[model samples]
Target: MKKNIKWLLLVSLSFVACNNDDETVAETPVTAGSANFSKYVALGDSFAAGYSDGALFKKGQDNAYPSVLALQFKQAGGGDFTTPYMEDNLGGFSSGGNQVPQFPRRSYFNGAAPATVSGTSATVLGSHVSGTASYNNMGVPGARSYHLLAPGYGNPSGLVTSPPTANPYFVRFASSNSTSILADALTQQPTFFSLWIGGNDVLGYATSGGDDSSPITPATGVPGVGFDGSYNALVAQLSTGGRKGVVANLPYINTLPFFTTVGYNPATLDATQAGQLNAGYAPYNAGLVNAKNAGFITEAERVRRTINFVAGKNAVVMVDEYLTNLAGAGLPSYRQTTVDDFIVLVSQGVSAKAHLTAGNGTAVPLQDRWVVSKDEVALLKTATDSYNITIEAAATANGLAFVNAKAIMDQLVNGGIRFGNYHMSATYVTGGAFSLDGIHPSARGYALIANKFLEAINAKYGSTLRPVDLGNYQIQYPASL
Candidate 1:
């Protein structure tokens, strides 16, 4: 009886093991939560359009941040994305035997220096650009925050003119001549949107060495006034559809390679050359004291205006408008650029190379437009801070994600960022961050930006989207192009 009971227990255990040996089930991938990517739209400036190598070309657009993001979005149920492609890889356009206004063809580094493809580029005809298809990327090359809200901004009638009331890039595929960029984007009824405006507002002024426009009152005048009003209105409108989006703030312009590459004290002078430069400025330095004593300038202005050059790394002399007009006193307002002063990248060669002058001969300083003074940098900082505040507040209020582009730029400029197999910095062309234009990002840089956007979206919306392998994105076409 005991043997029979033991045999029965062994049989029951063997039967349980056999039942557990069936095929296992595979788990399904995740899906979009509340966010819908059935229709995605991107609203921004040149960066959004993938303007690189100094022009908006087909290759650049194909690698645009939005385009890169759309591919990742596809994995998470995102749908089709389209852009108003330029006529050809050569970029620029011509109609009726005339070149497109304002858009010079793409430039490439031809070993020696930057050069463009000669003659007329292959143009995209009116038929291709026309139709009711909504443009997924409405990133007008030069559009500002206010321009997106301005009515009739895509009017074909104004594309060829000076203070262009309409944007030529928009005119290429605008649904109607009276359509604003925001209006056109709205017509698509996007389920998801990515907006990065307000860069051009202060950028236009900052890049011009503070000569073109004023940064003050930008995005933060009175509640209903100027940049502040326009920016708020644009954000409010974009949020109307309750579609999720991400907004990026501007970087401090002075920190960019455009303003930081040319150092304030780049003059590497020998002992004799240094002596000559100092001797030349002695009379001008003495004139500053005299001007101060005569009440022409204050004591602080005298010290600030003084120009002294030592044997080693000497400051490049510059024409400062702040110095009291000393021409009456038989002097010019010439002083070396201080640490507070920042020179534009375009002034790199022109500032160091001596040129013909009326009195000082080859030693005359570069003009004020070439160097943005300490005071001007202060103005830029104020405007950038104000604009960023508005951008951050709007993102929070609208329940959208905010990408701190300013921090990314700071990291790139200060300590270079490593993204996969590449190292990108804000050090102009070679850095791989900015293109030949020294403003927009290269393809790899845009890929990294798309990754940032993805990270933000995944975190905010509880999605599982993967980032692009930065190594996959090419930096530029062959320099020979």
Candidate 2:
């Protein structure tokens, strides 16, 4: 009787093992062109919103990559995709164009104030009241990851009590209570979703010179969610009910046109100007000598002096104390001063001068005031790594696809992909990829971004979506002065 029982047990275990093997074999592998995105929803910051040339205007917004992808998807048999778009006016940063109104025209304080007035035309993104279509895209221009989870975040009118009035992007799409962008998106019951969050969390800090003193915190912090916390929350909310989607990581701001476009090359200086620079630089050397005499640490002086020429038309070329040290250490030097550098330096000095100083000195380093320093770059990298970890973990946990946008941006700037007929670099204005602002992408540039997304999706979802032909998009060049 015992022998018979043991034999029966062995047979039962073998049958269970075979069933497990069958289940493993039944699991599908992702391949190109196999998966179809029938219904789609997209969420994230300015890049996702199709903000270009430093503004989110009608033409750029209409031609945003998401819209392009949606159109392509529809042609490929997917259903229509909608977005809470800014109808009458573009909502992000503004620039000047050929009688076509740019957005967020320069502030009064900035030397280059826009001649045109700035205000949002009262309209909603998907107001069926005016007979508009319900939008499925929810890419908020300045939204951080935590903003999405904020109870009143999507409420277009919930948080507008103070100066700068209200965010025009929110005002256009916001419904007092019932029609928050996120809530509306959730209610859509999307079959597929695309999310790219957490850019603004670090962006504001980076652009603001890494003060991090502002009230804003990453989704994990008390007053707000730090990047990690907010990212997880976003994944949790989207992944509920077994929903599958795609999420993209943030790119470093340094890679954008804003940073790369303003590089200084000492080689560009004329002989006379170079002599003047060498003369001006003598004081910096004197300062180093003084430090040594005064029993202060003798740091190496930077070879190049970064002058904020915009401080005044006649503003003297001030030595970049920050770059002085950096250059002394044999690091890369700043390119010569440009019109934009002057504007940014003056603007920052005026508003946040207290925070703009080098330790124990009235002399502000160019790296400290205008450009990103090695320390700040290190910090950004750390923040970026933390954010990417969260993004990858969330995607893995939720069975969603992840796009390494950071890597892609780096490659584009460092010569990774050559799109269209032009060999695109990440330089601002003429760089082919970035627009005038040096921060956002042009229409053709966005198409390249779309290809990155497609690659990730195909790899993870067993789908084969053909990348859009670069030739289909337009690349604008600066008008001759």
Candidate 3:
């Protein structure tokens, strides 16, 4: 009886094993569903172009989110997606054999700091790509919304104009000298599209320390003038004939690592140094007090403007134009930075160990261009919110999928979003999300963004598209590449 029972158990176990072997977990086949992706074109600025490590290169373009999406779309009948490929990985095109100072090579982590890659690129300013559809990507870096609608924005001749009316990236693949970004994209008649613009509208202003070099686009104006009107026009034109697409809203540009990585208090000083700095500002503090007494300023304003330093990490002094024009009274709008202020990333080099001795941010107050005051931050927030409203409205009115990029940024800042076992945040290089530039995403970060796009596309279109494994993408590219 024992032998019979043992044989029965062995037979039962073998049968279960055989059943498990025959029943495999099947993957959900990719499908386009109600949406057509046969001819898909992506339209946006730097993010859409995969401008990682502070510059655009071949590898970065290859891993762009649109390219990643196109590969997945191929499973459902999407055709070949063409890109305006850069000539080399060195980036920074030359004009007439002279390297354009504005455009520079890609940056990589050199164990201690972000360094520009060595080598010259063959990409020229007026040189056009050989193919016709190379503009399928249509992502011109440094483009604003209004720039997309302007004629001759890709005209190489305009590259020499004051303030540069043309973009070099667009000039590389534009069909004609007179063609606009919208025109080139519309000529493709893409069945599916993605729009993620308006960041540059305010990004320039924020990065330039709210300076005049790059002004923020106003939210209210006529079509082709204001962000609202220009965005609406873009949607209306793209939605002609009921074409389906996705629209992603702008994230809080001020919160990006370029503004957030550096703290307000990078001015570390010993007790002796702090005392000496305080002594130097004594006359200015006295003048602020006298100005308050003379009705030139309020007591609160006086306190805010008073520059004080202590032993340890003291807030850097910066020029605040918002302060009362005490310049007439021998005061130059000087104030110590607070938590609300952000020292621009470029200020890091200015406040380096060598320069700190020269008092770039201590003895000599940091210029307005090195700091984004609380007032400047408020301006950025207002513009970003206004632009997002127009973007969300366009998406809803056109029945297109919407990506809440602001929320994603919030997630990256608050406690990071996880993909598989890897987690990413906005904590600069260590966060595994933003690249060495501290503005754009790493390769793995872009892969995560591609997954987010897939999620929105599948939910909106009823497609069962699969997300690529996050493990496949690198968190950071090596300097060798």
Candidate 4:
């Protein structure tokens, strides 16, 4: 009986051990499977440079997604990844004693709102960094797809020219006045690379309210002229010599907080103010009616063109080019904004509000530069799709990992993405995903992006790359820093 009891106890212990082993998750060893990580390069626009809170500072550069990826790559034999770091945390740089207004200092969340930190930007754009011939991170803040292949893109002399042929960010660290961005990257002989261009292709147009000043790149031109061709050419060059890389598609510009933060109907007018606005637009309304009666415009267009102000919340008046030309009747194409339109974030600024209060949108109609009409939004969507198609095809052709940044952005805008215990969305500052500028991502948000890149890289290369904990990154930087 004693022998039987001992045998029963041993059998019970063996069963428990077997169950535990079955439930346990095996730790996958870190590896760089089927790929070389000895030299890694990152090429993109502001996002790749970590331009958060409106500027690229040392801290932001340190937390840039490329830098984050390099840390993880270290475990898998990734070599040194150097960056063209700014001299100070102040953000902007000076060019010949004049502060470059284009590159302003980073903003911080002041108790109530975001405010630019007070300091003179000390980094000099003409001052080249010593001892570094080629940088791992080749991200230029305002670069477009075609800009990478343009000669003299880093020439300091081009900075003074009208429209500025050179980007100040690239001019700071470019190898030579004549070397293009692509040329510089190729010189480094990177074994692996990441490409995240195309955002700036449409960003300039969207931010400028689809105005003619920053025209959207044509969808069907050849390389160095159009988005599709330029993007494909970029991929082709990056993939030379059987190199492996990752490419991310462009996200919809409209979904960003920069375009969505301000509402179409933001003005709340009192009864007296409303009456005054109505009286001011009465002549234009009467002219519209006459134009419709004269068969110059459709009745539907007449109704859409009519500007009216209510005593409570009201849509601000702005120019809509899509409206039928009523210039013959001495009437401009004017209409009040609707929910479908997007009022740019600049419209919410103190100066802009004062400009609107001064009868710009009430008595006189606002210009096309302040609002993006529903028609213009559709144009942006079409262009974005065209660019994305080119990007995806390039990835497939090159046999590279592809990240659907559009889907990730859609998730952020529609709902929210969860990482560990925290949730992030595209809600400007409060959402914890975007920076104060509403365009770039916050530090924590970059960590999420890094994880996504890792996921794509691991899946494509069949490697085991560990993702970082979101809790390690901060949602927003403090004002003191």
Write down the TM-score of every candidate.
0.85, 0.70, 0.93, 0.92
Model 2 agreement with the true structure over 325-406: per-residue lDDT tens digits: 4444333333234332321222242322233332211122344344444456567667777788889888998888888888
Best by lDDT: 4
State the lDDT at 224 in candidate 3.
Answer: 72
Better of 2 and 3 by lDDT: 3
Model 2 off-target regions past 4 Å?
Answer: 1-36, 75-77, 88-129, 132-134, 154-166, 178-180, 211-223, 265-284, 299-369, 419-422, 477-481
Better of 2 and 4 by TM-score: 4
Q: lDDT per residue, candidate 4, 58-92, as tens digits?
A: 99999999999999999999999999989888898
Which regions of candidate 3 fall more than 4 Å away from where they truly are? 1-26, 96-98, 347-358
Computed on alpha carbons, the lDDT of every model, listed in order, comes to: 0.76, 0.58, 0.86, 0.87
Candidate 1's residue-wise lDDT over 331-396, tens digit each?
Answer: 787767888998776532332222322322126676766778787888788888988898899899
- Displacement of residue 2 (Cα, Å) in model 1 is 46
- Model 4 segments beyond 4 Å from truth? 1-26, 96-98, 347-360
Candidate 3 — worst ten consecutive residues by lDDT sum? 347-356
**Least accurate 10 contiguous residues by lDDT in model 2:** 106-115
Error of 4 at 244 (Å): 0.6
Q: What is the Å distance of residue 32 in model 1 from its true position?
A: 2.1
